[model samples]
Target: MGTDNRIQTIEESTVYGLYHHGELIYVGCTTLALKRRLCFHRSDASKGNDAPIYGYIRKHVDAPKEDLEIRALDYDTEAAALQDLGHKTLNAQAADGAEYEGYDWTSEEIDVLEEESLNEASKRLDASFNQCRRAAMKLGLIDGDGAYTRVDWSVWDEALGTMSDPKLAEKIGCSVANVNERRRAKGIEAYQSRLSDDKVRAIWTRYHALEEATYASVAECFNVSKGTVARIIRKETYQDVERPPRITIEVAKRYHAQKDKSTDKGRILA
Candidate 1:
């Protein structure tokens, strides 16, 4: 019964060709089989017509042997098998042609696979966001006033740390625009204060040539719209009108005289 089962399995199995150095070394396939392909490769006699495959195996026997790995192609679909085969062919070509040397060649292949994986992951993320938005709408998380639940700043911080704006906004039960508006509002006071201080210092530090640093230039540095920058400069509370408190010769003389009189009075009292 076991022998009959093994024969039945082999008759129904699908095999793939393995290539080495761009040469077809073996032609075989598998189903839910008893032995792995690598196991066959390791034990098979390298005589007669299988001389080339045997020679290839012999060349690697003494060298540091890399493990043979199998990846599942779509088991029952021709298109899936072809796609996986193409990827495998490219990887094998790269490996045999010294395209990958010294480093982990398998890791490079896996990196390529990971990039393809991310595309699906990104699509799923977007789909999840849409589902959440719909559910939130049903739950009355969004009111008739067009205002959704206010995103906690802490949630925003965590979301920003891990996810993109659209994803974060969806997770936080708000629109992307609302998220941005909240972020700006949260920092507006500090941003405005910094800009105001920077503008005042710019004018003060370059008092000799205040025209050199224009409102437009400062605006660019602060990343605000040019019109906003112009408004900031125009409404700047600290102006160039009050020059730094000056120490004139007359004032200095008066101050010295006062100091001398005070010292003389103290000495006399002592």
Candidate 2:
């Protein structure tokens, strides 16, 4: 049908053709209200084919909306509405033209799958690369090449003695997965948390005794987090009390006009 046959206005329950400069940019049928669909086409959504069109409308802050036209079209069937919707048509290619065809594997193709990588075999047999890969995996053809890539672990082990995991990953030209595998094999812990019940008990005891114990003071005393102190005191009843969220500047000043926390007498014992 010619472009002249297209309707100028949008109608309810109609198959719409969105045009830009008289070329059909998109085609789709919406049973919902056409007004809502129009709004949805500009709703800052990046789903599929419409993503680029909506993105352009959003990005060009000064562009005129008048340039594009949304018009109703005539289609005898629902299938016709989708058949000619977009600028380009997607059609299936011949079996030989592509590396894959919808072919069930014979016993022969299945037997020699482990001979090479899935890609190389697919090219040789002129089959679908994805299908061949699936078949290979099911038939245990995936193990022809050993799973591990051999690297000199001696250098990596030496580096691991002093260097961090991230730095070691870069140096060995492998991923963090390999680095972690080496650590696990060598019985090396990534990071050992040094927190103990004895330390927590001491901190809690000292904080409960001192009325002037601020989170900063308790944190400095035990070298632990202020949040940890707050959680222990407020949630678990460490001090049987908790301080206000913020101490008044006057109370803090009365406690100490200026105190250096680095020194021993900076805070109230705790």
Candidate 3:
């Protein structure tokens, strides 16, 4: 997924040392505003958010606010600190506890699992944080009280895997031939290509935008080849972007603002 334009630099004081039961469980280094991230953790814990680490904290400990200690870890590079923590987490062994026995934190067998867990955590944090900021612009908080909406695609490409291209075309009110042509313009081989959730969300959002204004309109607005817009809408090729459920309008605004800034700064292009 693409990074947001609102990216902030991390300082030494921003790194946080995390401990469980007075023992170091992990160290988290982030470029997100410290106060914001901490608040997110607390709010997420209350809402049972879908973050692996947050879920782990909620499940393994009671009163995580009190049990899980957050201390400052001075580091020149927060990313490096996070990497070190991952390596340490992969190397450390867990001992039997009053609540559980033979807890192996660093089992070679589960190394892949640990790595996947860490990567998921990173992705979740980035997405959630961006969505929260966007929501805050229009809504005070991200709420789960909205109606559910699904996007369907119509055109299908064998290379893209198993996506229903015809259904997508029907949903978007476009011809399958047009969809396929757009995909070809974007060099997209299939409709159901393996893509990250973020990319899927971006494609959906873009497609919806095009639907609101028509494909030609969106192509003109983005100043890209019509085929590019069509391919994106058709999911021929996916672009990574953050997607958070129950995201607020404020967060969306922030996301757009960041995207615009990135484009202007040559950090990203449509």
Candidate 1 segments whose C-alpha is farther than 4 A from its true place: 1-122, 125-131, 136-146, 152-173, 185-213, 217-228, 231-270
Residue 224 C-alpha lDDT in model 3 = 52
- Candidate 3 local distance difference test against the native: 0.46
The weakest ten consecutive residues by lDDT in model 1 span 94-103
State which candidate, 2 or 3, has the greater TM-score.
3
* Most lDDT-accurate candidate: 2
lDDT of each: 0.42, 0.50, 0.46
What are the runs in model 2 whose C-alpha is more than 4 Å off? 1-12, 45-50, 56-64, 76-78, 88-270
Task: Please provide TM-scores, in order, for all candidate models, with all chains considered together.
Answer: 0.24, 0.23, 0.26
Tens digit of per-residue lDDT, candidate 3, span 74-171: 66544666556655442233222111122122222233322333223225443342333322211222212111112233333332323554554444
Task: Rank by TM-score, highest first.
Answer: 3, 1, 2
Tens digits of per-residue lDDT for model 1, 76-195: 533344445644442222111101111111232333323423223235443343333332232233421223445567645523424455555656645666765654444332222334
Per-residue lDDT for 93 in model 1?
Answer: 26
Residue pairs in steric clash, candidate 1? 14-29, 14-30, 15-28, 15-29
At residue 7, what lDDT does model 2 achieve? 16
Best by TM-score: 3
TM-score for candidate 2, please give it: 0.23
